[model samples]
Target: MYTLAVCAEMVFRDRPVPERAERIHEAGFEVEIWGWTRHDLDALARTPAHFSSMTGYIRGTLTDEDGAAELLRTAEQSVRAAEQLSCPRLNLHGTGLDDKGLPVVPVAGEADGPNWIAAHRTLTRIAELGESAGVVFTLENLNTAVDHPGVPFARAADTLALVAAVDRPGLRMNLDLYHAQIGEGNLIELVRRAHGLGLIGEIQIADVPGRCEPGTGEISYPAIARVLADLGYDGTVAMEAWASGDDDLALERFRSAFTL
Candidate 1:
């Protein structure tokens, strides 16, 4: 069976982050968070919840010189924070996102050859940092049409290519299905391709159209669950979605979709 997790940052909006994490843990799910710099790490550490993953950097981009330096610097800080919570995986994006989820430094169109080369070099350095820090870093795919526009390397295929090129134990793909459903509809095939390449570090999910928990939207998560089972992907499957109505019900629906 796949290990299940929920993004505490999305649910229990009325409570503190630590309390939300505790609630998710009490419901038999591990927790995921974004931007550790915004939360009280000491308080989160006190909770019994096991952290699945957190944002790997506060500010940086994958394809620029100064941004690459910033990414590596904050990634090191993120690693230390991960240690406090015993989190084994740290998540990354192509660039830093603002409060509204827009990329801070948007790339207007497809990245050029130089951009790809620079991104690969930056990721290679990130892999080296992860190796020294005893943690794994995951590059997550995002949908450019909806939540994040103009973010370079936002596609699952792009993320998979970058990670595979690095081809190191310390670097892997986050492989978010919700974004894949929006950006590239062939979900099963994408999973197969990423898994076949041995590049998946973790998998995140949410139903499209509303970014709500499974069963609230068009995606048949149970089918995906079966596929993962067949693929023998015994890794973390995290729900990074909002509660459609009741948070508990949403979590139950998420669990049911993947229970198989």
Candidate 2:
């Protein structure tokens, strides 16, 4: 069976980071670390559990030499943080526009331009960094139609394409179900295809339209869980969703729905 990881960032909003992390860990689910600072690290040291994944941006385009250099520094910091925490993977976002309208793809481009080669070079460098620290760098798919509009690599296919281009064993895809459902339906087939190619490093789940618990929306998580089991993916299935009433009740139903 796959392990369940909860996104404690959105949940446990009223509690301290360490307490929230411990709460999720106590619930028999893995915690996905939101931020790793000196304080968070100190807090995590006392917890009974560890994190399954970490997600954040490098804050610049890989297409530019300076931006890529800055990204390398950021990647190194992230890798060191992951190493210290014993978290094996650091999640990254694919290239696209920044808030300043810069071409968030690497190396060279006009604002909003797609620079595949530069992006590839940048990810490869980060993968090398991850390899040195015994960590994997995962690129996540996003929903351009709503949540992450204007990002060049928002679809499952887009993320897979970049992964192939990067051609690094230390780099893979975070197959985000909610984003795939929004960008292009047929998520089960997509997951199967990604798993077959050994491209999936993590699987993030939340219901479409509402981004809530599984049963509150149209997504058939039971069906998704069956595919995952058939594929023999005994990994973490992260519940990155919002709870409606009680978080405990929502989590219970999520486990029941996705129980393999």
Report how far residue 38 has shifted in candidate 2, in Å.
9.1
Write down the TM-score of every candidate.
Answer: 0.99, 0.90
Q: In candidate 2, residue 79 scores what lDDT?
A: 73
- Misplaced by over 4 Å in model 2 are 37-39, 56-58, 96-114
Residues 1-260 of candidate 2 have per-residue lDDT tens digits of 78899888757778887888888888888888644542467667678777888853445556678877777777777777776667877887765345443335532212243567777888888878777777788888877667765565667887888887877888989888988999899999999898888888899999877888889888999999998999899777999888877888778888888886
Task: Show the lowest summed lDDT stretch of 10 residues, model 2.
Answer: 102-111
Error of 1 at 256 (Å): 0.3
Q: Considering only N, C-alpha and C atoms within 3 Å, which residue pairs clash in candidate 2?
A: 62-106, 62-107, 63-106, 63-107, 64-106, 64-107
Give the TM-score (vs. native) of candidate 1: 0.99
Candidate 1 weakest lDDT stretch, 10 residues: 1-10
| lDDT top scorer | 1
* Residue 49 error, candidate 2, Å: 1.9
Q: What is the C-alpha RMSD of each candidate to the true structure, in Å?
A: 0.6, 3.3
Candidate closest to the true structure, highest TM-score: 1
